[model samples]
Target chain A: MGTARANWAFLLGYRFYVAAFFVFLAAPLIAAGSFAFNDSLFPALPWQGFTLDWFFNDTEPKLGMFHDRRLLRGLYYSFVIACGVSALSVFVGTCNAFLFVRTDLPAKNFFYIVMIVPLVIPGVILGISILAMASQFANGLEEAHGIELGFLRPGLPLVVLGQFSFIATITSLVITARLRKFDATMEEAAYNLGASRLRVLTTITLPFLRPAMIAAGIVAFLVSFENFNTTLFLVGSESPLTITMFDRMAKVGSTPVLNAVSFFLMIGSGALALVSVLVQRDRTKV
Target chain B: MSQRDIKRLTLFLLFAPFALWILLLIVLPHIGMGYLALREKIGPRQYEFGFGNFVEFAMEPIYWNTLLRTGSMSLLVTALALIVGFPIAYYIAKIANYRTRGAMFLLCLIPLWVSDLIRAFGWILLLRETGVISSSLQAIGLIDAPVELLYNDVTVVIGLVYTVMLFMIVPLVSTLDGMDNSMIEAGYNLGGSGLTVLRRIIIPYAMPGIVSGCIIVFMLTAGSYLTPILLGGKNSSWFTEMIYEQFITRYNWEAGATFGFLLLAFTSLVVWLGLKLSRQTLAGTVARS
Candidate 1:
């Protein structure tokens, strides 16, 4: 009876601990989200009544996030860059999936390790290494043959390349996990049924891998959009949304507009995350 | 085309991109960065190859001191995350029902979906002078005046633990979920206390997860620049800040590359030691996470 009572008390204590842990995890985010509607310029307590001026007003002293030209441009640039990164990473990562899984490549273990090296290295190092290589290559070409490569400069193309360098590893992992589950006998059957290699690939294999690829693309897009450490070094003049927010939070104090932006991001990313989870769950059920 | 030709073409197509990706992005850039670090500016248009940049880093007290501070602080963050995360991971893994487990996992992942910038911004809202915590304290008469909580080492550690908590919890949950409740039950049946059962059965079983989670969290905290700068404010004194100052604020690529290499070396060494001590492979650790 004593042991039973002790066990009950322990369980109750454990439950309380877990509850407190979650509150710690969630308090700041909930605070930031709630403050978006606060009428006060500052994101503090004693809420001065709810207002939507942070999201809609275009006038001074209360400019909306949408009306802020820099914020909008940052959002546009982030969207475009995320698109480019997703497309490139998905395509190349698909190729990587095939290379590591399907093809009879020698020293496969070594190559696999090489592929995931980017995943472990710091993003800042990745950015700087790419920057160093590009600048040196550009300078060398100009010095030797009076040639110039505009794409090597810090710009959208470089940003896409830098992001792709690391983001592809994630897409590759996602696609490879799915591809490994694929039954190769299906491909063998396609070949035996007079389907050419290309036809078999396009019709049999790719169709099976389409869901994983789409999921991977979405993951790639979200990662690219939220990326800051690498993009910080690679961005030339056009800052992405993360960089813009970083500048604002570091330089200027918190504004309700930033809170409004945070709320929008939370909703948008929360929805995307839910969709991905559901999609993966459905695939597993099938 | 002949069958052999088609086969050869396919192999070529498969190998080209993989080789190009490693060479152009991973291999060549690192080599270039190393070479840049080696070069010393002797004249306006002339350069010489040497180890002066690395030597300079070693000779500087402030530089190495900041690196040590970053390392020790990162270690603290990793330890705190583990202590804080283990029980939560255990609760989710062992205590929750199957349906609620899914919901709890999603809740943990939600914060990660938001950008780190906004997450740090959230911390600013809660910890600043006129922020929620301070204002609330003032409101309730707990304090006469608001106290600034944003720019200190403790706050930086707290923010970092928050940032990397998900990494620790996911690995911990994945490993703990695989654990059999019977082992824990058996330990209890053998007259072991709860703490003893946890130490003897649970921790040993979850060792790989713990090690992997620690490795990832340590690497992240050590390399992190945003949280330290934002939460630590002017006194951040983080090593990443030094590298950033050299590269961007001062236009000293050589110095920046050297500092970057030192950081990379230190982190790699620690990760290697961690793997060695835990008897875990990098592949297993990374794939599980």
Candidate 2:
């Protein structure tokens, strides 16, 4: 009887715990989502009659966020940075995966350990550190060589570089996971059959890595698109969606339009994520 | 080309990009910052090498206190995330129907695709004085008036937990899913109560995942910038904000560099302690990260 009672208690506790967790997870999203359709200027309650004004309203006193040039430009900047970072990180990260899996190097583990340092080190620190390094390098050039490279300035270029530092580690991990699953014997067999190194790579290894590379590229783009902490310090004048949205909320104060932006992001990310998940699921299944 | 020469060339071709990128960006930046951290900045473009910044940080009660506060708060968040996340992870990994597991995992993953700024914004929309929770409580007659809930340590911690909960959950689920079910069944079959079975079998088995999850959550929380600032407001006194103040507001990169290193050192020390306590290796943790 005691054991049965204890079992009942455990089951009840488990159900309650799961229910509360679901609430905790869904509450903020539901509130923010509801505010998207809210007619109220502020994203607070009182059930201001529903209107779609915040999303597409482009007139004075009710200008929608979509019509806001600054916000749109921020989104454009996000795309540019994400594109740059995804390309650079995937290229270098794939190379790293190849080297780590395919070659013997001096202190390979040490290289790996150092490479992943950006993973644990906070993005803020990484941002300022790079800024410091760039400034010092620029100072040296100005004092010694008399050349000032404008690219060193905090801008989109710096934002890309700063983001790529860590995102590259992520890309490498994804590619390397795929790399490790390949049999070395197959490569040796190709080589023994008189295929050139380049032929083996293009014809065999690249095919094996394509799915992972595509997944990594998509993820890298998303990660870069949403990066905030590092970009906050590294960006000069331009703002991405994150920083622009932050400025809107913290500095300019809240608006329902931010809710509209949130809703838009939800739909976009949901669609993209659905595609990526399906692709990844298909790859793993096959 | 000679065979040995060809092999050397191939090796060089394979490694140059990664090696050069790491050296140029990752290694040099920290070295530069370390140099700046060691210096004394007195005037524009004028500096001297010294322990002055470190000394200043040591002397300032505010610096130490903020560090202590941020560290403690991160610990609290990490603990809370573990308690809240473990059961959910267990449910998804062990209890959920096998066919629906993919859907459940995707559900947990969906929020993370949103930016941290937006996630914190969601909290602000809910917890503000004029926000959803307070106004709803009033509507339901649970409160006499709307009481402000924004801008406090609790709110900040909750935001931190919310932002990084997926990080904790992913590792825990991965670890839990890899376990053999028979071991758990064996414990149950041995007349062990549920708690006893969990204590003797499940928790021990999930220790690496727990350690890795805690380390990642703690690192991210301790180093977090957005949530504390947005939710905790001015009195957040978060260490990263101080680093930001020195870097941007004060234009004192010297002090900011020192603070950055301080955060790194402090977090590494804590992570080292966690690693020691859990008997997990850094390499194991890196795989999870």
Candidate 3:
């Protein structure tokens, strides 16, 4: 609208600032990923010829992330946890959406605020609180009846619960937003046409909510995969990839192999995010 | 079955999951944590409920000081993210070509998709003494010695601002996107300068988005553990670090719970203050997203 009277100097400065902002966003990630290919032992710039050793080497000084048993196991643990978390979060989240959006539930506003509490609190506190409750429950059980509950200890189950507590809130937000936009009259019309409630839900409403469910699932998966603060407190002997990587980084500083892991994570998360965006776009168009 | 029976069934199905989630995850845990925090260790295996843990926190200067520092640093990070993110949000929302807006928005989301740990690792690669930036400066003869740029407050702020940038931008863009172009044109036609129009019309209209963005950025920054530790290094002195120490290192659950609650309480207070100052409700703040 102001093109005819736009300030040239301001425009130039604005362009420069935007360009710099993009660089600021991208530079660290690119720099980190570049070192993955560096042949140097230190992940630094000496222009030592690029090699696949960081990703391929098997032994000792230059162990590849793929070959590192500990890291691979950690990745496997993270995957299993992510799967469990996403499934639980999406299921519960959908139930939550139905409860909040479609029903004339009592104290709905109070419940809604309670649901959001998990999202606002620190993940560290979330992890700690879950840990405390589980341990206290476990301890009381042991004290009163000499009973032991393995899941109540710092373990994968607790990790899943901690992650799910907040991740479910995200999924609920997603599913609820889409559900709020849904035309409930369609279900009423189906009922008028002699369709059962279950039939209407499964055949019509579920199909409509599929995209939001899928998008929320993908988001839940990604969040669970990369989670650290919560996982750190609740993890048992078997560490997640984030914990493993952080330990390695803290103990031994930067290695090209860690950089290699970063590169793959960037690609993996980027692809999933792209899929989520496309799914949401598809929903919008529909 | 009667209609009453069907209604009962539906209610049971819906209320069960929601009740289980809130009670088991949210309500019980916080209650348990509160119990833990209130305990005073009287003997090896004996405990009694008291406010000793909270009292200790108030009595210790180092503890309270670290808490204050973490709060202030988070505030600074929130401010910085808003300042850095506003124009970019404006660009994407109003200035970018309609066809390219989606693509531009995607570009912003790309960095955030990568985990916070990886993002911090990237900063390490760039800011470390032997990292790219210092090395490049050396290669260009800008300096003779490698500068250790990592493990500092500035680096931590930079990492945090970068981490939370997308959050601020998204809400701002959404709010700004709803702004009518005719209003800006009206402002211009009325002889209002560009800066005046922005301050009066654009910002006021985007105030909800701005407040929400600030709230999210502040919450994320305050609760953040990895960025402050990884970027600020051993001297980070972040309050979360103290809580971590109490829980993981010292095995002092009582003290840890106390610190955790203090962090939660203070951050909530700040968030409440922020909402009040901006005249936005918590629901409204969250709704903007």
Name the best candidate (by lDDT): 3
Query: In what order do the candidates fall by DockQ, top score first?
Result: 3, 2, 1
User: In order, what are the TM-scores of chain A for the candidates?
Assistant: 0.95, 0.93, 0.96
Cα lDDT tens digits, model 2, B1-289, are 9988987887899889987788888889999999999999777778888999999999999999999999999999999999989999999899878977777788888887877877888899889898888888998999999888989877888889999999999989999999999999999899998889999999999988898899889999998999999999978999999999999999988899999999988999999999998888877776754
Please list all clashing residue pairs in model 3, or write none if there are none: none
Tens-digit lDDT track of model 1 for A1-286: 9989999998999889988888988888888788889998888888899999999999979899989999999999999999999999999889999988877778888788778878778888888889999999999999999999999989888999999999999899888888998998999998899998789989989988888888889889988999988898889898889999888887886688999998988898888877777667766753
lDDT leaderboard ranking: 3, 1, 2
Q: For model 3, what TM-score does chain A reach? A: 0.96
Candidates, DockQ: 0.72, 0.76, 0.78
lDDT of each: 0.89, 0.88, 0.90
Candidate 2 wrongly placed segments (more than 4 Å) = A185-194, B43-45
Measured with C-alpha atoms, the lDDT of residue A164 in candidate 1 is 93
Which residue ranges in model 3 land beyond 4 Å of their true spot?
A: A1-6
lDDT of 2 at B252: 86
lDDT of 3 by residue, B1-289 (tens): 9988887788779889878987998889999889899999999989988899889889999999999999999999999998899999999999889978888888898987788999998898888898788999999999999999988898889889998899899989999999999999999899999989999899999999999898888888888999999999988999888989999999999999999889989999999998898898877767538
Interface RMSD of 2: 1.1
